[model samples]
Target chain A: MKNTLWKALGILILVYVFAMTMLVPLGPGLLEFQDVNQVIESTREGRAVPEFQVIGFGTHWDQLPDSLQVFVQSKGQLAALEVIRVDDATHATVGLTLPYSLPAKSWNVLTNHPVDGTLLLENGLFLSDRFIDAKATWPAPSFIEHSSQLGLHFPYQPRIVETIRNLMLHVPLWFTMFLLMGIGFVASIKQLSNPRNQRDDDRAVASVQVGIWFGVLGLLTGSLWARFTWGAWWVDDPQLNGALVTVLVYSGYMVLRQAVDDERLRARLAAAYNLFAFVILVILLMVLPRFSESLHPGKGGNPGFNSYDLDSALRAVFYPAVIGWMLLGTWMYLVTLRMKRVNRQIELLP
Target chain B: MQGLAFLLGLESTAIAFAALLSVLSAISSRAGAGFGLTAVLGLPLIIPIVLISTRYGTDILNGILWIDTAHHLLFLGALTGGIGTLGFILFPYLWRD
Candidate 1:
């Protein structure tokens, strides 16, 4: 009864993770540039106001005109601009009057829509020193601000959008794999300490067998995610390579077991090899990857999932997925142990 | 101080891999003339680690991100750790017969 319940829980949690990962929508945010008018050098020097058009995605365009304000984000200050026209939903033209003391270089154009919040178009306008007088004192622009919306949606990361959902899948599989392997490591220690006990040897082999399955799943899912986000099925990433090496080393452990003929000798040699494999797994998966720059987050200088990636909404599903997968792996290990015991019983009957 | 550390790391990693290869060869030979076979098998496997460590060591000497080098140092720890644990656990088995 307990076994069936644990298995059911694993399946249920996976289904929930898959559904939530696919269903949640990305928050309303700036998508891309629609049309931007070039700021001419002579016109920039003159006193006339400069106008530009921008298109936005996931924005509440209907609350425009009165509630809309635009700003040129330059030199750490937000310079407010006048909204010349609202062309349509998702389109607007805003005008900015340059101060005599404006800083040279391109400034980001930010729109403050009451409903959509602040949307930014990076490097929207360029002010060359060739046009503006160098000695002119730049006018400080007033800050244009808007209240952020309250809703449940995925955070807008620059590169990863829908693929961010893979976090609940890819990350948790590796975590579960580690948990299973940790069990194997402990079992191997017990087998070595008391070489006479056959159960400890069985437990070590069973844990490893299940752990390898999880490791393979981790590699396959990671490869799929990498193909979409990193633009290749495989990149020369340290983390990915380390994971590959770990799988290979563990696979070698299975090969070693097959070559030995004597039962007790096979068990002892396998236990020792399993311990070696576990240590190498730690080195390859956890230690080696950290030193090299990798596309995978939480490695090198990149912020880990804990920082901004695993937001509250993600954490809600992510934690459960890990626990579910771990329980499932443990259950699989127990089944393998039972099979080994049954096989031994049959051999004794003969 | 950093250069000395890099040199120490490089030498230690090379020594460790060599030692691990020798141990692996010794174990494989129990089956047959397995030293040659094990060397042939293991050299290819360990080359990637050696190549990466060399490249990373150069990066360290050239004043790349110190944090990055520190992470690579962990890789060495892992290599030594696996080799060390395997040696301790498996040596008795090899000596039993």
Candidate 2:
């Protein structure tokens, strides 16, 4: 009863992860500006006003125009701008009045909609040279309060907007692969310590076999995501290369086992190789990728998704996904081990 | 010159070399050469895979275009093909013993 309950729990968590990751809408945010690089020139009539269109994603356009606020961040200070018009579901035009002596060459445009929260377009405008005394500081905009309740939603990330859902699938698969491989590593150690124990050898091989399946799934899902976001099915990324190498090395472990004919000798050789491969796996997947630059997150030069981008809402689903995948992987390994034992018994009967 | 070829075209070389080493190690184990010798011989052959992957991986991390990586991929493909042909011819001899 307990075993069935545990299996049911794993399946339920996975179903929850799948539904939530797919069903939840992306939070309201700015998609892009029609003209991100609008030039504002200095004029005799005070500040020069430049107008540009703003396109928002997942935003409700039914709100009043007065409620939509825009600001330009220049010289480390945010200056409030005037919204000239709000046109339809995704379009808006905002006017920015620049100071005569703006020290900053670039400015970021931020839109604060009353119902949609804050959306930012980084370095959205370039400021041209103007004639005014160099002020020590720029005026800061007053903090606008938003009262809209942004129900359950995934955080909006540029480039990986809709494809961000793949994170629930891809990352958890790798996590489960690592967990299963870790199990294999432990079993290999036990096998090596007690060379006579056949069960330890069975456990090691079973874990690795299932772990390889997860690794393959990870690679496939990662490739699909990369195809959508990075514009390639495969790129020369350190983390990606590392993952491929780790998988190949483990595959080599299985080949090595098949090559040896003697039962006792095969067990010993496989255990030793398993230990070595595990060390290499750690170095390839974890240590080396950190030192080098990679397009993948949590690696060199790239901020992890969990840093600021993975909001609490994502964490609610992501953590459960990892746990669910791990449980499922473990169950698969157990089934494989049982099958191996049964096969061995059948061979003995002859 | 051979070392440079192996270094620059590591992934393909490693794939071929790993297959060769696994076969050799398996044969050697049967002949009582033991796991130590198999590992010692295999380790050096696989190093190029690690070296080249990390070296080119840096460029990839900096977002190199696919066009720029064409040469690397080409060289890797050539090496793999050559080694695979060699392995096919030599495997029968290796397998008999």
Candidate 3:
């Protein structure tokens, strides 16, 4: 009864993850300000500044965002811009006039919408150094600023875009793999310490075989995520190589078990190999990737998605996904262990 | 000068691979599967040495001072020690039959 209860809970949480991962819309983001002037060199003679197009992701430009506020911010001051037209949900025509006695030559763009909240693009605008007309009237910043939005949203990442939702699906697979392998490692140590305990040997082999299944699933999901985001099915990367190597080593453990006919001899040999293979696992998965440059987040000085301001939104689904996947993996290992036990019992009977 | 620094990494790699190979060879001999068994078992254990040495060798080639690579050198030393220690402990059981 308890077994089925936990399995049901795992399924429930996974359902929640799937629903949230797909349904939650991404927060608005500034992609590029198209048709931007080469430089905002405002002249005293000609038209002040030309109109430019702004591109955004997940923006509601079509619904008449009367609260659409675009500004150039520098040195704790802002110059509000005029929105000339709205092309669609993703694009808007905006106009900005240079404010004299400006603090910096390059400034970022900040957009505030009633529905989409605030979006920013760093170094969105650049200006020449010659303009220093203190007497000139700067565009007064009179727009009423809106606070953070009320709706739930995942962060907008340029690399992964909408596919960032894969985080819930892809990462938990590897976490489950690690947990299963740890089980296998512990079972192997037990078999080595007491050779007469045949159950431990069966447990070790069963858990490891299940671990390999999880690891391969992790690789396939990871590869799909990579293809969608990194623009390649495979790339020369430290973390990827490490994961591949770890899986291959465990597969070799299986090969060794097959080649040896004697049960006692095979158990001892396979247990020994497990000890060595676990070291490789720690080295490749835990140690080496951190010391070198890796495209994977949280390694080699790259800040992970955890560092994002909107991380709480992701954490809401991500934590459950991890727990759910781990529960499911434990359930699989138990089933495999029982199958191994049945096989052993049948061998003895015959 | 770079060539000399790389030799140390290569040397550590050789010692690490040899330790892993000794155990693998015994298993292969017992299985009587020869190179097929050896290659599958050996590649995973040996690749870490290749991974670390390539990183170290590239550093030397790029003019990163030998002192700066203390971490990788330590990693290599630790890997060799680990494989050797495991071989020393497990070889007895493997050789008994």
Candidate 4:
């Protein structure tokens, strides 16, 4: 009954992890930026900034407020105008720009370029003017107000937007892998201290099995992310190659364990190799490559950590992702240990 | 059997719903599947729906379509729900002798 309960809990936890990963809105959706022609016609009677209306999925023609006037009347040719509306509850904002050109009885309909027509409520949702806490008015020139000599504007890459969510999955896999391997290292060290204790040997073996799984998951998620972000499944990056080498060394530990038949001798030698492999793994994965230029984080030439990456929404989902996956990994280890015990019980029955 | 197709379809739908509920559970508990299953199921459902809506959704939104968007959502929901429930029901039996 207790075993079944644990198994049930494990399944529930596994399902939960998969669930959060999907439903969490942590990445960019269909983004559209179009040059809207808002024309203000003046025939010497008076100058009026012409009001323009755009009709689309969320905010159709009917949703337009009768109280709110269409155009911001300006004296001079408006170089850049931005309207920011912040939602009081979620604190998310939508900024729309007023582009050049508007004439009498002229209306435009601009749909999001890559419209996500998901049945999900978030897909076609639009920011209503009512829910806004405050609106910040800024000129286009204000964007470059900070710097004049150097202005860096990253190209709008779709892959970068999609791959941003991968930070939760791939990075956590490595973190969990490191953590598992660290446990293995400690267990191996303990076994080295007391060569007589079989429990230490079993623990060390279990850690390696769990650690290897995490490493494999890391590689798979990383490769998938690489395929999307870098346009290739395998890239010749320093960090990528180093991680592969680290995983391979750990794999060798498994092979070495199987080669030896004597249990005592196998445990002693495998534990020693595990300790060695772990040190090398840390150096390869976390230390050496970080100093050099690499595409992967923690080992890259990029100095900034949170700049343009690790947005608030992504962070909210990411921390939990790490915790959930790590817990799941630990759960798998427990199950494997139980299965091993069951095998021994059946073995003794004969 | 008619029941089998309905059962499979229902299981798929249940798995889909379970995927959603599981996500909410993860959020509250800070542990579990996280968001993998929803994403997998979402891809097939969301992509087609989003594509159909964004490009052709204007007509649907304007109420010109023969079938409402709700119906489509229902079909998808039912299909996923059915399948997910079927899977849950079969889990115990799967390991049984």
TM-score of each: 0.83, 0.79, 0.88, 0.51
Q: Give the backbone clash total of model 2.
A: 0
Q: How would you encode candidate 2's per-residue C-alpha lDDT over B1-97 as one tens digit per residue? A: 3344434555665676766566556545664657765665455336535455545555455667545654444534543554455445434444331
Task: Name the lDDT of candidate 3.
Answer: 0.82
What does candidate 4's lDDT look like per residue over A1-350, in tens digits? 97566556645654664565565543212233223345444332234333323222222112222211112222222222222221221121222333323211122211221221111111122222322322323352321211111122111223365455566678878888887788788888787677775677777778789888888889999999888877899987657766777777677667666655666766665675576467557655665455445777555565333646554455556666677667767767766667766776797795
Candidate 1, superposed: residue stretches over 4 Å from native: A33-35, A38-55, A63-66, A85-91, A96-110, A119-150, B1-10, B30-48, B56-78
C-alpha lDDT values of all predictions = 0.73, 0.74, 0.82, 0.50
Better of 1 and 4 by TM-score: 1
How would the docking of model 2 be graded? Answer: incorrect
Give the deviation of candidate 2 from the true structure as CA RMSD: 8.2
> lDDT of candidate 1?
0.73
The candidate scoring highest on DockQ is 3
Clashes of each: 4, 0, 0, 45
Order of candidate numbers by lDDT, starting with the best: 3, 2, 1, 4
**lDDT string, candidate 1, A239-320, tens digits:** 8887887887777777767766677777777777677677777766777666677888888787878756677877887888
Compute the DockQ of candidate 2: 0.06
Report residue A327 deviation for candidate 1 (angstroms).
Answer: 2.2
The DockQ values of the predictions, listed in order, are 0.41, 0.06, 0.58, 0.01
In Å, residue A338's CA in model 4 sits off its true spot by: 3.3
